[model samples]
Target: MTSVRVAGVGLTPFGDHGDRAGRDLFAEAAAAAIDDAEIDRAAVDQLAYGNFMGALAEQQGHQAPLMAEAAGLDCPATRYEEACASAGVAVKAAVEAIRAGTADLVVAGGMERMNCLDTGEATEALAIAADELYEVRAGMTFPSAYALMAQAYFDRFGGGRADLAHIAVKNHANAVPNEYAQYQREITVDDALDAPPVAEPLHLYDACPITDGASAVVLASEEYVTANDLDAPVEITGVGQGGDRLALQDRDAIAETPAATEAAEVAYADSGITAADIDVAEVHDCFTIAEAMALESLGIADSGEGIVAARDGKTTPDGDCPVNLSGGLKAKGHPVGATGGSQIAELTRLLRGDHPNSEHVADATTGVAHNAGGTVASAVVHVLEVAE
Candidate 1:
């Protein structure tokens, strides 16, 4: 295989896009990324788009072609959907395409226009990822599914609502300065305590908002980067992915994400760096419980101790091994498909010294993006470094 380098990254603001469609949002972000790369659109040999609800939201299928025409690109296109992990999967596809010598330059991105639906309609749309035979029939929503995991973790361990609330406070505080984040204001512990309940243990604050946004990145082969004089490229050092049983009932333990653990093992091995070496991370925080679980799953913290770590300010924006400096999906908004690319864009900015929240992981040279699809059914872990 060959090495891949990220040449440019682009992102749309994370919030409600009143009337913008997925095609429009994606095209705008893709154009910015291509421009940022200082490359011609015609040079792109492939396009990979990440979106979970094109069929539901836009009543549009064949998304890749739609996006291609919108972006005015004539390359072969592929649409990727791994639920919330869509953009991460698209990023992985772009990397693999370059590594396999199938394409030297590829544009990978994600877009979601979720503001079109009301809460009930949105919940129904998201329910498609659940097990129709079991989960959906049981009237379980995403928050309820994750709330089950939270309840199990608390039962097995000793934490409670207070621990989860702390995670909210910290990430909210971190989101204050993130201009692109969905929730940009800081919230107090009382604010968290008073938020409307979404699920028993998960509240409005604990859950990410339905956001509409898009993000894009340009990936090129190492040979292409060198020949084209791509400046300040970030090297894709390691990539790992794993999948698990879709239904939560099939798992032996809700506290553990076996797919995440396996992916982390491969990421650590391939990157030649342990969790200790990672200066910063952008992990999936679709729910506050997932944030704590992710720290453990990534081996950044021991199992059942992620709450303690968060409570102790160990995962604060300026804390050691800061996680989710982009305000995370918690504060940054989970635009379903666009989330993973959003993480990469934030990390890329951090590496380029363009990010204002430099204190999160100052002097950081290594970064990680841990993305998961539908209740840990799929996961992709990536390690990156400042290119040589």
Candidate 2:
């Protein structure tokens, strides 16, 4: 019944680290988080590491213990994997552990060393996160899944490729001020339209990059926070998760993210806050179309109105209900397993008002972070409030 607060947040730059391995990056980010929290290594009772592709990429399967040993933190640790929602799942688990009085301090992190393989190999490895028997075996790539969703949106909403293009342009523009973003270069909607097609209706500019990165956070109970005098702590007011049918064919419509909507509904009820109370949000924008769908799922926009809202500058960094001020997965790079952790880290910075691009959102007392996994089959939503 107790509240959990973030004592510290840390992240390595989100980019392709040609020589770094996932374990190495995880250790670095974990150490940084421990230092930031000013908590002794021994105080960390548990370690929850989120990683989706270590086995396929490096044949490094046992990650939690390996990460703990590499970081020199002799604590019980476990690996969490819900595809790209891995880190967000870890966050929820860490909070639950604290609420259950099982641990006072824990380290939650995610790491992905992509770019170690060629595009084909990388895509094959990532496909393991999907429903292999039904989806991957049927030859459906992630982009194809999203492309179907984009077409559905257009067909149902009267918007087409142009709407998705606007999302790409807006998010890239938002990324320029974010030092950790993978794509900081601003692009015009015309540029997006002209880009090569990755999948039908989804151009190169609409997709997130294959990134390598790590992120970490120190989670502590509210009692522990006050006892330790943590600096600028932020309480996790709500945490909820929901799952949908694994195969895209099982869903009634491709455009609607049912899991995201269900998760957000649970989170809003638990936190006693409506979408209107959210000052800033970090939504999963793995694809341009995903961003628009997220807006609808979060109830921030009516169905099919997300693109219009975004194009009207409503989702701009300084605009009403700013979304993805951290550049989002689209421009910030999507390191699969590490993405959810990175999203929370960005929110931590926003909560502390320490993000370099401070003008993005003003006086954000409450914020939300949403992440989805496996073609929106699973989702995790959380609401954070500034520590009183």
Candidate 3:
């Protein structure tokens, strides 16, 4: 067995790229990551890429080989897609390959181009990630689905829109200094509350925007890192993936994400730590309610208690276990496939003391990244620790 080290991380700005092709975005991110790794480009043995809607957005179903060429790599490339968790699974596969001794170095990441599509086209494209027969045909957009979750939470757990707004405000504040973030301007709670309603309970401010971008990370085995003297300071100590009923109607509870809970538990066990050991987190916050759900799954908040954590000042930057210091998807931008890799990239920089938000978690030694697909029907969790 071998440890996986994140030798380098890179991300294109997480916002609209106008007419830039997906390949072009991925190429820039891959090049930046390879450059940051400071290793011979030829040493990279494989590429694990991810994209969710390339066929619809760019008419490219086979994105891995195209991206491999675009990134100027001469290695076998494989593509993984689990909707929003696409990059996460790709990274996990790259780690597994390194640990299995089948590869010494690998590049893992994802790219998404949503701004190119019209609003209706993009919504329809994203809806394909849901259950087509049950959810899509019934006209359940992500916002409406999350809104139902929020309503269910309020019905069962006793929180309201105000609580969720705090999460939006907190994440927006965190994004202000993040150069790659889409909406760096902070929003007040009132602003979030007053924003136009996308759904009953989820307002415009509560949801992540349609972003277009790419992110990449270079991974090396412990042996490769030592043999090459790579300056990698972040180690991926644990990885886990979990899945549940795909449709919300089939789930036991509409407000909870058991898949995320299962993934978090397994990842924590793999890392030889409990949830209490987590010092920071970057979670899937496609909607504000999702941040609460993720925190509960990670045990940062007790069941039914996550919704108020931000409002209560428990999950804020100065709190005991700060979360989403990169502003999260709520403000940092959610470029579908690229978001998972972006979370890991942001966490690596924060752990390495290079991110603008690092000061908030200066003493943090361990962190978690959680990504989910399709209302968290599928989820991936990874534990990262500063190298000893």
TM-score of each: 0.97, 0.97, 0.99
Q: Which stretches of candidate 3 lie over 4 Å from their true place?
A: none
Clashing pairs in 2: none
**Cα lDDT tens digits for candidate 1, 1-388:** 7788888888888899998888889888898888888887888999989999878888988899889888879999999999988889899888888988999999998999888988899888988887999999999899999999888888887788778888888887777888888899888777887889889888888898899999999988888887888774688888888889999998886877889888888888987889888888888989999988889889888878986777887887767788887888989888998888888888888777787687556688899999988788888898888776
**Mind giving the per-residue lDDT tens digits that candidate 2 earns over 212-272?**
9899999999888778887746888888898999888898868799999999999999889
Candidate 1 yields a Cα-based lDDT of 0.86
- All-Cα superposition RMSD per candidate: 1.2, 1.2, 0.7
After best superposition, candidate 3 residue 112: deviation in angstroms? 0.1
Best prediction by lDDT: 3
Question: Using TM-score as the measure, which candidate wins?
Answer: 3
What ranges in model 1 sit over 4 Å off? none
Worst 10 contiguous positions by lDDT, candidate 3: 35-44
